[model samples]
Target: MTNSEQHTEHSEHHTEHKHIVEYGKYLFIWLGLLALTGITVSAAGINLGNWTIVLALVIASVKSLLVLSIFMHLKFEDKVFKIFVWVAMLTFAIFIFFTFLDYSFIR
Candidate 1:
């Protein structure tokens, strides 16, 4: 093979080496998600004013993170990718915060 072709093949093989997650880890994540879902449902039945929404949001966020890391394979991604995810989440939170602020003033 030519030098350029050899270099391309080598780089491709190098990047192909990725983390291999075990089945047990996936099962655990799935089970945790189910438990969180159950808790959220149970919490919904009892009213706690504003805290109900906050509690639901917190649990949803945790479940989302678990899905992102395990199901989406973000756990094996690079640091930059993880940072990007956090930035996106922060931006979303900021938007929600502003929206709530605007809503509260209207009431």
Candidate 2:
């Protein structure tokens, strides 16, 4: 084979290797998150008073992280992308907090 053909083949192989590794890592993370979801649901049914919501939220946040990092490929993305995601999350939190505050303090 010509030199150019050989180089192309090598580059393709490298891309395939990276893709396979990423897929395997994401699969493992997804399976673990699924198991955690089951646990969270079970815990929620046990009547933990206020803590049930907290625990469920914590578990959901973890699952969101896995989905963002693995399924969305954010783990390998640029810092700016991550910052944008954080900003969006902060905005959502602010909206929810203010809504809760308004509801709790209404006359």
Candidate 3:
């Protein structure tokens, strides 16, 4: 084959390698998150008072982060995207906090 053809082949191969690496990383992350979910569910079954729900939610949040970073490919995304995600999370947190406050203060 010509030199140009050889170089093109090498470039394509390099791109494929990078894609495989990314895919493998995502797969590993997904499996790990799934395992964590199972553990969290089991932990919830145990009696832990008011802290049980909080712990379960925290674990679910971590699992969500794994899905976002790996499955959704947010890890390599722009900072603007990260900011938007954080803002949304903060809004949800505020909503939950206020709801809990209202529940606690109810007569």
Candidate 4:
């Protein structure tokens, strides 16, 4: 092969190497999500008074994190991307908190 052709092949292999992920990791994440789903369903059958919503949201948040980090490849992304995600989440939480606060004052 010519030098240029060899260089092209090497670069392609390097790019492909970065995207390789372990199948076991995805399987474990899937199982974890399934277990969390089971908990959410079981919790729905019981009455926990005012704490039910909190419990469900907590579980949902955990599931979301797993999907985002593992499935979305955010865990392998740069620090800047992670920082942006955190900022976005923080902003969303603030908005949700204010919404609840508004509702509390209305009643």
Q: What would the per-residue lDDT of candidate 1 be over residues 1-107, giving only the tens digit for each residue?
A: 11222232346434433456789999999999999999999999899999999999999989999999889988777677899999998999999999999999998
Instruction: Quote each prediction's TM-score.
Output: 0.77, 0.75, 0.68, 0.77
User: Residue by residue across 18-60, what tens digits does model 3's lDDT show?
Assistant: 2223567867887898899898989989999999998998898
Top-scoring candidate (lDDT): 1
Model 4 Cα shift for residue 82 (angstroms): 0.7
Q: Write the residue-wise lDDT of candidate 2 on 1-107 in tens digits.
A: 11222232345334211322356786799799989989997998899998999999999998999889778867766567899999999999999999999999994
lDDT on C-alpha atoms for all candidate structures: 0.84, 0.77, 0.75, 0.83
Give candidates' CA RMSD values in order. 6.4, 7.0, 8.0, 6.7
Off by over 4 Å in 3: 1-21
> By summed lDDT, which 10 consecutive residues of candidate 3 come out lowest?
12-21
Query: Order of candidates by lDDT, top first?
Result: 1, 4, 2, 3
Clash count of each predicted structure: 0, 0, 0, 0
C-alpha RMSD between model 1 and the true structure = 6.4
Worst 10 residues of 4 by lDDT: 1-10
Q: What ranking emerges by TM-score with the best candidate at the front?
A: 1, 4, 2, 3
How much RMSD separates candidate 3 from the native structure?
8.0
Of the pair 1 and 2, which is ahead by TM-score? 1
